[model samples]
Target: MDKDQQNRITYTVYCINAFAERYRLTAKQAFAYLDRFGGMAFLEDCYEAEHQLSIIDAVNDLTQVCRNQGGKL
Candidate 1:
């Protein structure tokens, strides 16, 4: 993969793991929730800015994004 694509994947996985831990969910569960609730799209569209932030900050942003999209947890 290209460096930019690879970096995006790495950052995305990092965010998923951090999010999972923060929410006490498995990585798979986290992925599903994020994917279903629009968090994945938000992350992709905002990757350049999001990855510059700390993982906690990214997760917080994702949490809000998901909540706005109707995610319960």
Candidate 2:
């Protein structure tokens, strides 16, 4: 993969781990949550918003989106 793709993958993994830890989810469950909510795009947006948004806030946003889509994390 190219560097950008690698970076995205790395960030996705980080987000997956974060979701898992913060929500007491398994890795598989975390991946499902991310995938269902918008996958890498969601993660990238969250990272980009880090300066203006806390990770907890980002996660809360994602959780709400997941719920709106009929999924829970």
Candidate 3:
């Protein structure tokens, strides 16, 4: 699901697990992608991966962006 579709933290959690399952990505791998690249990069990578961008990816990506922009996550 996309960020707008993630209605609750539990849903976010579910999306994370679903994303991991669908892509064979470890939680760490998924998180690292976001941490190193941020939202645009994450979305781009997802598109490159196969057109599946989930909310968990955005959470991590946005976190990375915040950190990069001095928000400290």
Candidate 3 weakest ten by summed lDDT: 42-51
**Model 3 spans with C-alpha error above 4 angstroms:** 1-7, 34-73
Task: Write the residue-wise lDDT of candidate 3 on 5-65 in tens digits.
Answer: 4444344455445545555778666455444546335444444342344556655555556
Error of 1 at 69 (Å): 0.5
lDDT per residue as tens, model 2, 5-71: 7876676676677778888999898887777767545567665564256556666766776777667
lDDT of 2 at 2: 100
Instruction: Report clash pairs, candidate 3.
Output: none
TM-score of each: 0.97, 0.65, 0.34
Flag regions of model 2 displaced more than 4 Å: 37-41, 44-54
Q: Model 2 lDDT vs. the true structure?
A: 0.68
The whole-model lDDT of each prediction reads: 0.95, 0.68, 0.50
Per-model clash counts, in order, read 0, 0, 0
- Candidate 1's residue-wise lDDT over 15-59, tens digit each? 999999999999999999999999999999999899999888999
